[model samples]
Target: MRRTQLRRWIVGAVAIAVSVLVFLVPFAFILITASKTTQGASLLGFSLPDKWVLWDNIVTVLSDRNGLLVRAFVNSIVLTVASVTIMVVLSAMVGYILSRRQSRWNGVITFFVLAGLIVPPAVVPTIWVLQRLGLFKTLPGLVLIEATFGLSFCILLFRAFVATIPRELDEAAVIDGAGPIRLFFRVVLPLLKPVIVTSIVVQSVAVFNDFANPLYFLPGDQNATVQLTLYNYAGGMAANQYNLLFADILLITIPPLIMYIFFNRQIVAGMTSGAVKG
Candidate 1:
């Protein structure tokens, strides 16, 4: 008993140490650097600031270029909300259909869904399509891109979770004179709270932090997402404001961090929900 207890303690201690090193240490470095002067931040070592100027850095970053960061934040929020909403709704419906109906086309549909995850997006072709559709360099177009890229993964998650739901519920709903839409919306959707929350939280972070998609599909200072705001402090004619850059990173990082912290348990539950059953 003593030996087992000691082993458990050692394992726990190691896990804690690893977690601190991997996550907390880096976060601390970012925090410290963001609070430093430009010269101090340029050194980029993990140390406390001689004088905390975090508020000053944040103010400067927010006010830079007539408050580009503020506009970027609005763009990011809109992009994330729109794309994630589309992903959740579309993926949920597709997953439910796939779960309940096993047809000859199911295999083909699943194959394509899986391929979306496996296949690397053809950037030039995608751009050509966007241009042809007159959606090039638009926020709505980027929303579609984000939604499509995330769809496959979200579908898999929802499909697995949907399998855990019994067929009896559907039968009962149908017998109660509920139409297909009514059945799904009224009966099935409510019970999908856990997985829904999971998808929203997961995709929201992905869309909000997405840089490349917005860069390629949605250009212009007016359409800049928060991640693109990092460029305003770095490359091109931008100055060497390392402090403000780190400050921007920290600012943009907070939403996702808070999300993960609060919904940590729900994410675990949603991911593991259908594992045993399906």
Candidate 2:
């Protein structure tokens, strides 16, 4: 028994160490590159800068060619926040109905939602559809698209969580003269705390880091997002400013990274609670 436990502990420690090293290596590389100067960067040196140009690089990246980075940053914020908002509301409503109301169409609605998981997005066709709908190349349009993609998974999460909540609560609220809206807001909704937080954290991260939808749907330097900003920077800035490019990458990574670090526990708890309860 002692030998088996010892072996398990050793293996677990090794696995954890390996995982941490794997994560740290790329992060270290990015930091080294981010801190390198134009000349030092050209030499492809993989150490901290002899003279730190991080502030200079930041100022340049943000101000270069009339503040494209600033615009991109703002665009990213808008896209992420707006999409998450729409996704949360729409997904929660759909999930509530699916869980509470046993309509004949429940299975069909579920099948259609699950279909979103399997059906690969027809990017070109989707763009065409967007154009036809008069929704192309705009932030609101992009928000709707992202929300559509995110809705299914979020609905599943919410439905699963809500399934664990008792129907008696709804009945009790109704007995107390509560309307459907009041029961939802005052009674049923409050019990969905864990899953809602889970949805917010998960969807917020995804929408913030989204690359392709923004690239294909909303194409313009003026509306460039953080991920798209890198493409523009890499193509325009060239090798001499690769360090600055690295700086730009770091800038874009910070917000999501900070959010995750602070809320990681909340995310884990929320997801686990919802999944287990439902």
Candidate 3:
């Protein structure tokens, strides 16, 4: 039995190693392709380049006359930051109230939130509503759209985590003449660290990589986001510089890659910490 378990572990490790290679190989090709000359890149040579064009390509992409790539990058950051901030606050507040205070409508609220998990967004209707409200084609409109999508998930996480926090703290603080605001911010919020960290990781990745919302709501050359910037890689006059295009792709992908590497463990812990006896 011990030998069998050991063999299973070995097989699992080997499978994981191979999976990593499969996932990383394309990215590896991107780096090599990005550094190579146009001829070398086109030849599919998977070795060091004789003439490095890395810096030149970077400058060209960055300094494009249209300034679309850089503008898109900045827009993505704005969308991600604003969306995440609103999501965290709204979720935490709603979660706290639902978990901490007793209410007759709690079940209805929970049902609604769970239903959102399965609901495919009605995009055309959403756009029409936004337009009616005069929120079309604007940064604030996009931010609100992201926050709305994130609301249910954030609230779910917050409630699950808050349930694990001892209710005695609230009672104790109240006995000491503390108000609800003080009790939550000064006492309870600090204890929700694990779950908050988890939400941050999950929501951040979603908002950063969000392509559909940006495409639908903020569609324009000037408002293009990072994911949209990949269109420049098309195999035509626009996609002439495959090397530079691959390099720009590499640049756009790096920040999220670094974040996941550093915070993946925390993300998992936060998501699950409130699940079981939290």
* TM-score, every prediction: 0.98, 0.92, 0.90
TM-score top scorer: 1
RMSD (Cα, Å) for all candidates, in order, is 1.0, 1.9, 2.3
Worst 10 residues of 2 by lDDT: 232-241
Candidate 1, residue 29: lDDT = 83
Deviation (Å) of 14 in candidate 1: 0.7
Query: What's the lDDT for all of these models?
Result: 0.93, 0.84, 0.86
TM-score for predicted model 3 compared with the true structure: 0.90
For model 2, the superposed segments whose C-alpha errors exceed 4 Å read 1-12, 43-45, 236-240
Over 47-98, each residue of candidate 3 has an lDDT whose tens digit, in order, gives 8888988888877777775777889889988988899989988899899999
| Candidate 1 backbone collisions, by pair | none
Q: What is the lDDT of candidate 3?
A: 0.86
What digit string (tens of lDDT, one per residue) describes model 2 on residues 124-236? 88888889999999988899899999998889888887888889988998999999888888888888777777788888889888889999999998888888877744775
- Tens digits of per-residue lDDT for model 1 on 86-150? 99999999999999999999999999999999999989999999999999999889989999999
Query: If the candidates were sorted by their lDDT against the true structure, best first, what order would they fall in?
Result: 1, 3, 2
Models ranked on TM-score: 1, 2, 3
RMSD of 1: 1.0
- Stretches of model 1 off by over 4 angstroms after superposition: 236-239
In candidate 2, the residue pairs with backbone N, CA or C atoms under 3 Å apart (3 or more residues apart, or in different chains) clash, namely: none
